[model samples]
Target: MLKRLLCLILLCAALPAAAWDNRGHRLTGELAHDRLQASDPAAVQAIVAIMARHPDKARFDRNLAGLTGEARTRRLFGLMARWPDDVRDTPADRPDWHYALKIVHGWTALDWYTAGKAEAQWAANLATARNAAAPPAQRAVALCWLLHIGGDMHQPLHRGHRLDGSWLKSDRAGTIAWVRRGPGLPPMELHQLWDKVFDPTGVDGGDENGDVTRLHAAFAPRAAAMVPDGGFVQWRDESEILARDSAYTGPALRATKAPAEAPPMTAAYMTMLRTIAERRVIAAGVRMGAALQGLR
Candidate 1:
């Protein structure tokens, strides 16, 4: 049992970093799917048809096996949101497209930023998705990327990477700022901590459907207020503000300067992180829904 558990942790650590874990990504997709269904059922139909033309349609089919109708559609949308992370290091992977790192040092925003092509890639994919003349399979791939990247942009860490005095280099969205959840716990990347905040006990091990339903209901009241009225640029900027003001506060900032070992995150800090993370996830879902509704 001990050996098996160790292996699981190692395997998890080997996985590439993403804006959110599978459960959070699924929730974002599910919410967007629901929004699209309510406002434009025809758009949902169109999206489903386009997804059927994906080059990896067989892979999708395998995952959707034994499921049908609404359940299948909802799960497929969630899969769409997670597909990019699933295909990392493949020819289709665009690692840089996952983040637009507005660098910071301490409390000050730096003038220089990394060449994160999230904005450009998102626009390109959107154009392809909307272009009637584009090949069906190509458009299908574009649509998948659109779903994934839309969620990526709303993750605050994906929007900024800090430059700590200790390193004088970007933390690469907190990938290196290892932190402990409690005393004697194994060190985990700060990025990983935030990524799994929504599904801490493991998405598969928890009540994912219930959590999704709960999150959607909780945020539904704020849906009208959370829409990205100013567009993707505005969404990116909002995440940057949160990353600076919320994510990089106090204990998280201190972890950056720790010499070697991962520092412990305060209990109060963890509580606050959870609140910010939940809000960000809902905002991402709402904005993604709006983007899909705009699809021609």
Candidate 2:
């Protein structure tokens, strides 16, 4: 039964979705690593030791085995932060782990909540993770979820798809809104653009083992100050509303239910989108950094 369940989840992985590209996840992990370490050094050490058993052990070592002193520690913590996404491709991974059901607005719980939701799992996993007596492997898995899914929940789209009686389906959290990069530039999915674009317009940080320089938390000062003292539900509450935000709004966006035309993504709109995307990335980092209280 467990193997069958894992197979089902693996099929769901065919759908495309990424809350924050590697860089964004890395940034969030770094901030959270620092936040937890500064106040609870031992907690950070304990988590990292377990993560050393991450299913992808060889990759973890080859990529994160450089630097010295605090630099090495931060980088490992940052990489472990992204470990969950890697799990998405593994058989035992949770296909729905990257997102939660919309928990805001009128959707208060009555007893119908699914344990599979990222909101539920991250919080529950925190408790599992804090229990050092649990199997080391179980604790390691929980740590990855707390880091990766915790960050993903902060991404507004991942809060949940919005479908009012219409077919827009919240444009699949902006994925259906095909955006033209410039007047004649190659177009891409609006959601993907948000995932890929950078602050100040064109800061290109290669996503690789050596990409830590640009992924540093110091690069985003405003985000560092925006960390909130909250948990999974609060993070979802904050991000779920952004579906209606201007970045995801437009005539083309509204018609995405069935057959629809691509949106005319304007330069001004692109600039505004960049701004909102940057802030969201920063906020994810800040909140994810401070979100480790229970697990720590």
- lDDT against the true structure, per candidate, is 0.74, 0.61
Would you estimate the TM-scores of all the predictions?
Answer: 0.85, 0.77
Worst 10 residues of 1 by lDDT: 7-16
Clashing pairs in 1: none
Count clashing residue pairs in model 1: 0
Candidate 1, 182-292: lDDT as tens digits: 567667777877888876463236876677667657765666465456678988888888888878887787664353578888888889888877776777777677777
Off by over 4 Å in 1: 1-17, 107-109, 202-228, 256-260, 294-296
lDDT of 2 by residue, 1-296 (tens): 43234323323333334677777777777777777676577777777778766666777788666677777777776776677776565786776767754422222231123223676778778787788788887887777777788777767667644333342123445566565555554556666666666432322344454454664634556654564666666667676666546544553354332223444566777677667666766676666666565453
lDDT of 1 at 202: 33
lDDT for model 2: 0.61
Best by lDDT: 1
lDDT accuracy of residue 91 in candidate 2? 80
The prediction achieving the highest TM-score against the true structure is 1
